[model samples]
Target: MKKTILGLWLLACLSLNALAENIYPISREMGSGTRSAFVDIFEIYKSVNNKKIDAIAQKIEITNSTGIMLTSVANSKNSIGYISLGALNNSIKPISINGVIPSVENITNKSYTIFRNFNVVTKLSNPLIEDFLAYTVSLEAKPIIQKAGYISVSKGNFKSKNPRGKLIIAGSSSVTPLMEKLKESYVKINPNADIEISQSDSTIGVNSVIEGIADIGMVSREVKESELKKGVKPQVLAIDGLAIIVNHQNPITNLTKEQVRKIFLGEITTWEQIQ
Candidate 1:
């Protein structure tokens, strides 16, 4: 215990000495719904000639997908990033924000404030697509979604009408994990239905549906009004907390909303500063 304390003290001192050098903050690339929701939730913007422009610090590392975000944090020291709580695993440590752990109960009860909608988009839905979508919003999918650490919001019963067809679902990597589980359960009951998912960013998911390439698009954030204008309908499947994660080696656990906002905005640029 003494040695561990001494080591941490020494490290903190080193971080203090270089207040703006080593700490790395990671975020998703632009056009990502997860990034959009994060910026909105945290109010990460600035007025430029009266227009509110996104003002994420230039130094923040950008990853393309939730998988990349997890891997980047796991491999890098003094790194911080965020991903869907449903996707969290043992590779990284998720820290509490404002003393509230990102859990299903907290998200469902509305205590954990950092959360976003898990939306599924569709354009000119076919009968097969509608049937599968019906299954997604029914009570049967509730346990599967909840089991994946997301807050299931649907309460309905679905009886598959023996629909048979092939369909594609593409979109936000953040929503893919839960969607995959839901797909597995749906396919078992409706054996004639075939579904393939292509993993990518949220923007691509919306566009793909608009272009008539995919029957369904999974997006981590709510479907934008701009997207709605394109004649696509969005179905919110569940609610998910955006889990702030760090390398497992990091010791500090909790951060205030203000602290996180500052860190990503380049105001708090070091581990010691956050400490």
Candidate 2:
């Protein structure tokens, strides 16, 4: 009787441990939709493996926030997080799965599976927004996004007459380089157009656009459905990849989507366990 009770208790403990696993977002990462898709893929992989996976970290929470800030938080040990390639800094490292680190070469060629298109959002009613949108769609701004760490969606020459009006653009710092590139090109064509670019998180950028404070909003993530209800249309300009990097010293290479989720959720906590 005693032995049977002990056995039952052990089994129950194991079951509870298995049930503790879950998927959640890492704060500061770009592309919430991409994060959602990654979670879905990780869950599917775990189901096939027939083993309960551990959480990499709890859902990332932030106070003073940006995608880069959230990414910095998530980049800590045993944590799997994603951020735009342009946002990478010395503090964080990208993860390698199957020996492939997400990069421009891999993403552009479609060798990297995790990627999404970013947008240049604007209000339909604002003429300045319309002109900026037109310029973004023109051939001049296409290569600029690519040069700034994103992949362009279209190719065409811009023919708009320079509007001599002041315009404001706000978005993630990850979008800064792309924005700068676009500004340079736009200025070349319409030398008199006054453009100002501001850096902030995706949420803040969207908010500014909603408040009518900015003519154009650039975001590394898709506009939320809620934002759509407010009259902001996310016009996709280019595709970008969120890279998961690691310290060069870490020997482990190649992590599956499931493993990555586990690492971030604080489930599997060591390099050896990963092996």
Candidate 3:
């Protein structure tokens, strides 16, 4: 009878250990293009049957920065989150959705539907800003953007002369990493220009441009119609993708699009449910 009791206690301990592991769903905060694009591609709101937005609003963690999202997921063995594909590295494991792995070729060929534009917004009247915009979309910036894990929008022969003035670039944290890389390259060539960057979300970026606080706003998604009415002009610079990532220790991978949507909707609650 003592042996039987010992066996039962051991079994209970194992069961308790298993039950202790909970799945964590991490999400980007509102005004994030990464979040917006992710929601649109997954049809998350629609998938919940026009259900309460709380289906998404109630994520286990809400991050305003992509770096935070990366850290949050990387630290938790059961945490899952999404981030710009350009920012993806070995710190976390990117999972395949609907059997599609996020990659440049997949996005370019339209096989991966999780892509969005990196846009720069400025007033339509500034020639200097226009010149900078031209530089961003030109052949000169293509290799730079490609090496940063993004695809430039188009190839053009235009060359931009450095405008020797102070300029501020702010917006979407999703675009900030790649933009920082581009800024490093741009500043090296244009030593006379003083440029500053901010890594807030997209809405604030648009507002900054409208309020005249920022010379240019770096947004990861298209400008909103309301912002267009406010006289903000957005120019597409490059195309980027968002990757759904989990801790490298997580055993489950290769979720279907439906499964991911459902997971965020709170319909699928535990690691056990997914397994």
Summarize candidate 1's per-residue lDDT along 204-226 as a digit string, tens digits: 99999999998898887778788
Q: What TM-score would every model get versus the actual structure?
A: 0.92, 0.71, 0.87
Candidate 2 has its poorest 10 consecutive residues by lDDT at 21-30
- Ranked by lDDT, the better of candidates 1 and 2 is 1
**Superior by lDDT: candidate 1 or candidate 3:** 1
Candidate 2 per-residue lDDT over residues 13-57, each given as its tens digit: 754553343323343433333443344445422343765433224
Q: Candidate 2 lDDT (Cα, whole model)?
A: 0.63
Give the range where candidate 3 is weakest over 10 consecutive residues by summed lDDT: 46-55
Candidate 3, residues 167-243, lDDT tens digits: the string is 78999998888778777777776776677898899988989999999988878877878899999888887999889
**Candidate 3: residue 150 lDDT (0-100):** 91
The RMSD of every model to the true structure, in order and in angstroms, is: 2.5, 11.0, 5.2
Tell me the spans in candidate 3 whose CA falls farther than 4 Å from its real position. Answer: 1-20, 46-55
The candidate scoring highest on TM-score is 1
Clash number for every model? 0, 22, 0
